[model samples]
Target chain A: MFGAEFVPLSLPPLVIGSLAAVACALPGNFLVLRRQALIGDAISHVVLPGIVLAFLVTGSLGTWPMMIGAAAAALVAVALIEAIRRIGGIEPGAAMGVVFTTLFAAGVLLLERSDTSSVHLDVEHALMGSLESLIWLDGTGWGSLFDPEALAYLPPELPRLAITLTIVALLTAIFWRPLKISTFDPGFAQVIGLPTTLIGLGLVSTAAMAAVAAFDAVGSIIVIAMFICPPAAARLMTNRLEIQILWSVLFAVLSATTGYILAGYGPLWLGADNTVSAAGMIATVAGLILGLAALFGPCRNRAGAPLGA
Target chain B: MLLDAFTLGLGYNATLVTLGSALLGGAAGVCGTFLFLRKRALVSDAISHATLPGVALAFLVMVALGGDGRNLIGLMAGSALSAVLGLWLVQKLTRHTRLAEDAAIGAILSVFFGFGIVLLTVIQTMEAGKQAGLESFLLGATAGMLKSEALTIAIGGAMSLLAVLLLRRPMTMVAFDPEYASATGMNVSRIDMLTMMLVMAVTVVGLKIVGLILIVALLIIPPVAARFWSDNSDTVALLSGAIGAVAGYTGAALSASAPSMPTGALIVLSAALLFTFSLILSPRRGLVAAALRQLKYRDQVHMRQGLLAIALQQPIYERLTLNMLGKQGLLRADGVPTDLGRARAAKALLDEERWRALRTLPQFEAAAARYDGLTDLEQILTPDQLTEIDAHLNRPHGVPA
Candidate 1:
C-alpha cells in the first residue's frame, strides 16, 4: 500500500508531526501535573507574532530565524503574563488571556499591515500549518530511506523536530527530581530551598521551547493538543511519573500516525475525493484517547487507591 | 476618510456592520466582567474556539439541504450546538477526571478547533458558490457583509444586552461569592451557564464581523480594563460594556476607512490600547495611582524622621529629608531649625515617646495598632489619654504637667 508517491508525499509529514507531538507531550506531563497545561496554548499564540517579526527583519522564512523569533516572543509573553498578573492584581488565567489575546491580535494586525503578501505567512497558515505538504521531495522508494543522497533532501522540519525532541527529553531527565518535587508540593519544594520560582520559570521555559519548535513543524493546533491531551490522558493511567511519561509518548505517536493517515486516506476510504487537515485529525484523535482514559482508565478517579508502598 | 467612517459615513453596509459590532462588543464586555470576576474568563476562550466546527458544519448542512448555506441563523445554530458540546466536555472532564478546569479547557478548544479546521478544508474543496464566507468566520469579516447579516448581528447584540441587564444582579452575586449565591438559593451553576451562554451568543453573532480569534479579546479586554477603574462589580460591568462598544465602533470605523485593515484585529488592538492606557493611568488601580501612593508614603516617612532629627539637635544628612524640610519653610538658610520647626520637632519627639509607652500598655491596644511612625499621635489618642500619658513622661512640658 505504501508506494513511491507515499514515501515522498506522506511519510515525511507523518514523521515530523509525530516528532513534534512527542516533543510537546514530554514536558506536557509536568505541565499537566502542575496544572499549567495552557502554557502551551499561550506560547503557541505568541509564536505567530514572533515568526512574523522575524520575517519582517530577516525578510526570509529560514528555519533558524523563525525559531529565534518565536523563542524571543515566547519569553516576552511569559514576562508580560507575570507582569500583568502582579501589576493588575488579576488571576493568572485572566492575565494570561489578556496577554496572549493581545499578542495574537498584534500578530494579526502586523501581518495585515506588512508587505509580506508574497510569502506563505497568513493567519490561517499560522494556525493550521500545511502539515500535509512537508514532503520528502528527493525520495524515490522504500530503499531511498537509507540512501544518503535521498535523505539529504528530507524536509527541514524533520531534523529540527528531532533535535527539539532530544532537548526536551534531556531537560526532563536532567531536572527530573526537582521538577517532580516542585510539581507535587511546591511548598515543600520551597522549604527544601529548591528555588521554586526559578524552577517554575524553568518548567515554563522548557514548555515554551517545546511549544515553539512543535508549532514550527505542525502548526499550533497540534502544539496545543499534544501539550495537554496526551499527558493528561496518561495521567489517568497511573500515578507514577515515570510510567505516565512513557504512556504519553506512546499516545502522542499513536495520535500523530493515525491522525495523519486518517487525514490523508480516510476521506478516500469513505469515497471522498480529497484529504482533510492532519493537525485537526490528530487533535481529534488525542481527544478521543483522553475521553476513553477519562472514562475507564485505572486511576481515573480523583482519589485513586494509594500506592501500595 | 477615517473620520467619515467613524461618523458612519462609509455608506449603508459599513454603517450597519459598525453598529452591529458595537452592540456585540458592548454585550461581550458586560458578560466578560462577570466571567473574569468568577475566574472563568478563559472558559469563554474555549467556547469561542469550539464554535469553529459548528460554523463549518452549519455551512455544509445548509448546502446539503439545498440552501445557499450563508444564512446567519443557520450558521449560528450550528456554532451554538458545537460550542455547547465543547463546553459540556470541559465541565464533564473537570468534574470526572483529575484534569483541572484549565487542562480540560485546553483540550476541548484545540480538538474542536482542529476538527473544525478539518471541516473547513472539506468545505474549501466543495464546488459551492457561497462557501467563501466560511473563512471569514476564522478572524471575522466586517467588510462587504450583507445588510441582513449585519442587521441580525445588531439585533442579536441588543437582545444579549437586554439579557445581561436582566441577569446582572444574580450574575454579580454569583461571580463574587458563589457560596453566598448558593446559600441565598440561587443556582450558581445555572447562573454560570447563563453567563457562558451570553458570551457564546455574542461570539456567534459577532463571528461574522469580528472572527473567532478576537471576539474573546472583546469579552476579556474591556472587562479587564474596566476593572482598573472601579472595584464595584456593577460599575465595572457598566464601564466594561461602554469600553467594549467604543472599541468596536472605532475599530470598525478605522478598518472601513482603509482597504487592507482586517476588522477583528483592529478592534482587538483598539481594546488593547484601551487596556494599556487603563493599566498605566487609571486613578484608582492603575500604575500611576500605585506609584503616587508610594511616593506620598515615602514623603510622610521622611517628614517624620526629619522632624525627629531636628528635635534631637542632630545634623540631618539625608538629602531628601533636608530638601523636604526646607521646602516646608522649617529650616533656616544655614539649616538650623526655625521656631515653627522646633515646635513641630518637640511634638514629633513626644509622639515617638508616647508610641514606645503605648506598645507596653494593654488598655490602648486598638489605638496603638494604627501606630505607623507616620500616624499623628493625636489621631489615635484622646486629649484626655494624651494628658495622662504626658503626665507619665515626667517632663510635663505641653500642659505644664
Candidate 2:
C-alpha cells in the first residue's frame, strides 16, 4: 500500500501535516474555549508586519528570528485589539477588524515600499502558500549527521514542522492542567491564582507559531482552514477535549494528504489545469469533513447551545 | 486632485468609477449591518474568496460557448451562484452538525477559497486566454472600468437599496429581537432569508472594486462606525450608508491617484479609519463620552468631600486628616478619639474650634456657625444604616445579613 512514490509524496505530507496539525490543534482547542475563534485569523493577518520587520532587520529568512518577530507581532495584535476595546469602545470583533485590517494594510504598503530583492511576495501571494513546493525543498542538508552514504536526506520543511510540533507538544505537556482549568472557568482559575493571562498569552503565541508554519505550507488564506477546520470537524464528533484533539489530528493529516493528491489529479480529471492549490484544496476538504461531522456527529441534541449559556 | 480631475481626461473616468464605488460601498454598509448582527461578517470574506472559482468556471463556460469579451455578466452570475451555494452549505452545516457557528464559518470560508485557488491555478496553466480579465476579481482593477460596468453596479446597488427599504421593518425587528418577531408571527426565517439575499447581493456587487479578501471591510466598517452615533436602528442604517459611500469614494479616488495602488486595501483602510474615528468620538457610546462621565463623577466626589470637612468642623487641619486616617486603620478601638466618638459633642467642639481658628473672623462666625450647624449629617449614614452596613460586612459568605 505504501510504495516508493507513495513514501515520498504521501508519507511526507502526512508526517508534516500531522505535526502542523498537532501544533495548531492545541491552540485551536483553547481558542474555541475563549470564544475568540477569529483571534487566529486576526493573529495570522497581524503577524505579517512582524515578518516584514524581521526580514528588514535581519535581511534573511532565518527561522528563529522570523518566528520571534511573527510571535511578537501576534502579541501586538492582541494588545492592539485590547487597546481598541478600551479606547475605541468597540467589541472584540470590531476592535479585531480595525486592528488587524489596518495592520495588514500597513504591512502591504510597507511591502510595496521595500525592495523586491529582499523578499518576493505580493499581498495576495503572501496570504496563500503552495505545499507542492515543500515536497521538493533541499533534501540533502543533514548528510554529515549520518555516514557519508547514509545521509538524513529529509525535506527542509519537514524539520521546521517537526520543530514546531515539538514546541507545541512541550508547551501542551507543561501547561495542560493550567490550560484546562483556566479554559473551563477563567474566573475560578483567576481566584485560584492560575495565571490565566500567561496561559492566554501562551495560547496566542502558539497560534502565531502555527500561522508561521502553516503560512509556508498552505498560506494565510488557508492557514485558518488548517488551524480551525480539523478541530471544528472533530468538535462535531466529540465533546471531550482529548477526543477532539485526537480527531483533529486525524482529520488534518487525512484531509491535507488527500487534498494534495486530489489537487494534483484535478487537472488530469477536470480538463482545467486544476488551479485549485493543494493547501486550499486541503482546507476545502477539511471544511467538508467538518460539514459532514456537523451533520452526523453524535452530539446533535446540544448543537444549538447559545453563547455563554 | 479634484482640480486635476477637471483638467485630466482620465479624471472623468475616475469620477464615474468613484460614484459607482461609493454606491457599492453604501449598499454594502447597509447590508453588512444585518450580516454583522447575524455574526456573519466573515461570510462576506468566504463569498468573496469563493467567487474566484465561480468567475473562472463562468469564463471557461463562456469561452467554450464562443462568447465575446463581456464575461463580466457570466462572472457576476457565477459569483451569485457560488455565494448562495456557500451560504447554503454554511447554514446546512450549522443546522445539522455539531460544529459551532464559527467553525462552520471557518470551514466554509476555507473550502470555497481552496476550490477557487485550484480553479485559478488550472486556468493559469491550461486555458490562460479564456480567463484574461478574470484576475481582476482577485485584487480588482478600477482603471479598466467603463460606463457599462458602472451601470451594472448601479443596478445591483439599487436592488440592494430597494430590498433594505422594503424589508426595513421586519429586518430591524428580526435583527434586534428575533424570538419576539417569531412569536409575533412575523416569519422570522423568511425575513432572515430576505436579509441574507440582500447581503449576498452586496457581496456579489463588491467583486468589481474591493475584490475577494477585503470585500467584508465594505460591509463591516461603515456599520461599526455608524454604531457609535446611533441607538436607533433607522439612524444606524442611514449613517452606515453615508459612511460607506464616503469611504468608497475616498478609497477609489486614492487608488485612482496612483494606478499601481490596490483599490481593495485603500477602501478597507478608509473604512477602518472612519470606524476608528467613530469609536473614539461618537455622541453617546464614544470614548470621549465615557471619559467625560468618569470625570464628572470624580468632581462630584471631591465636592462632597469638601462639604463633609466643613460639617465635621474637627480643626479641618493636617492633624485632623492624620487623625481621620489613623481611625480607619486602628488595631484597637480605644485608639479612636473619644471626642470623635461623640456625635453631638463632636459637632459642638468642631464649632468652637472653628470660631477660635484664625481663618474665620468674629464677624463671619455667625454665618459660618449657622452653615456648620446645618449638618453634613444628611449626607452621612444614620446610626441604623451604619449598624445595617456593619451587619452586612460581618455576615458570613453566602448567608444574607
Query: Using TM-score as the measure, which candidate wins?
Result: 1
Model 1, residue B400: C-alpha shift (Å): 11
Best by lDDT: 1
Candidate with maximal DockQ = 1
* Per-residue lDDT over B41-97 for candidate 2, one digit per residue giving the tens place of the 0 to 100 score: 665665666676677778667767887534566788988888888888778766766
Compute the lDDT of residue B397 as modeled in candidate 1: 66
User: How well does candidate 1 score on lDDT at residue A76?
Assistant: 99
**TM value for model 1:** 0.96
lDDT of 2 by residue, A1-309 (tens): 243445544556656665666677668877765666777777777767777888778877677767778778888888978876776456667667667767776665566567745465555566666566555222233332344342245566778888888888788878988998898899999998988888888888788877887676557766777778887777766667877778888887788777777776655576654435666677767777776776666654355343244
Q: After superposition, how far is residue B154 of candidate 1 from its true place, in Å?
A: 0.8
Model 2 stretches astray by more than 4 angstroms: A1-14, A53-66, A86-89, A113-118, A135-156, A185-193, A265-276, A300-309, B1-12, B38-40, B68-70, B129-133, B306-401
Per-residue lDDT of model 1, residues B1-401, tens digit only: 98899899989888888887888888989989999998888898899999999988888989999998889899999999999999999999999878899899999999999999889889888999334568889888777778888788889998998899899999999988999999999998899899888988988888887888778888899999999999888899999999999999989889999988988988998999999999999997889999999999999999999999999999998999999999998988689999999999999999999887777778878887888889978887789998777666746466754
lDDT (Cα, tens digit) per residue for candidate 1, span A47-95: 9999999999999999889999999999999999999899999898888
Error of 1 at A10 (Å): 2.5
